[model samples]
Target: MTADEVFDDIVDDLAGRGVSAGKMFGARAIMLDGKAICCLKRAEFGVKLGAGSAAHEKALALPEAVLFDPAGKGRPFKDWVALPASQSEHWPTLAQAAVQAAH
Candidate 1:
């Protein structure tokens, strides 16, 4: 799905779970009791997320997690880890990680 779709689905999903949802970086950010959990980011190069510093370290431990494409032009938004398009099932995993990072 597209970034906007990602944002919309995520927001609806999280909110359905009683999480707070809002906009960030022209995409969507999710929060649990006001603490961030994840976001769907729209970039010129591709759809991605900038899961903060703490999330970066934790996500590294997951088998499915990966740093965004090395050559990707998202250097300006450091600490971002890109999930491949094929890893659709991992969105929840990634969203959780993003929330972990923000918290």
Candidate 2:
């Protein structure tokens, strides 16, 4: 599925679980209690799973997965993972982890 479609599915699934759709750094994002849990940027699904956490490590192990760097600078968000379309299947699971971490 396309990134948009994947994002839609995540939003729908999380919405019922109390997550809201919002914007983060101008990108479409899933929010929990007003904090961004994940976002879609350039077809990449960026999720905040906390640095060094099990979820973060697993996500980084995925092909093409990387630390999120919105500005394209070397300074990346340690707690965020940027998952490419190839890793879309894992988005939901990681997104759930993000929500839990946020709580």
Against the true structure, whose lDDT is highest?
2
Please write out the lDDT profile of model 2 over residues 60-102, one tens digit for every residue.
9999999998777798899999988888999999998998888
Off by over 4 Å in 1: 1-9, 16-18, 32-37, 43-76
Query: CA lDDT of each candidate?
Result: 0.52, 0.90
Q: Which ten-residue region of model 2 has the weakest summed lDDT?
A: 69-78
TM-score of 1: 0.47
Query: How much is 4 displaced in model 1, in angstroms?
Result: 5.1
Question: What's the TM-score of each model vs. the native?
Answer: 0.47, 0.94
lDDT tens digits, residue span 1-103, model 1 = 7655655676666565667766545545566676444555543112234445554665544555556444446453356555544555566666755544444
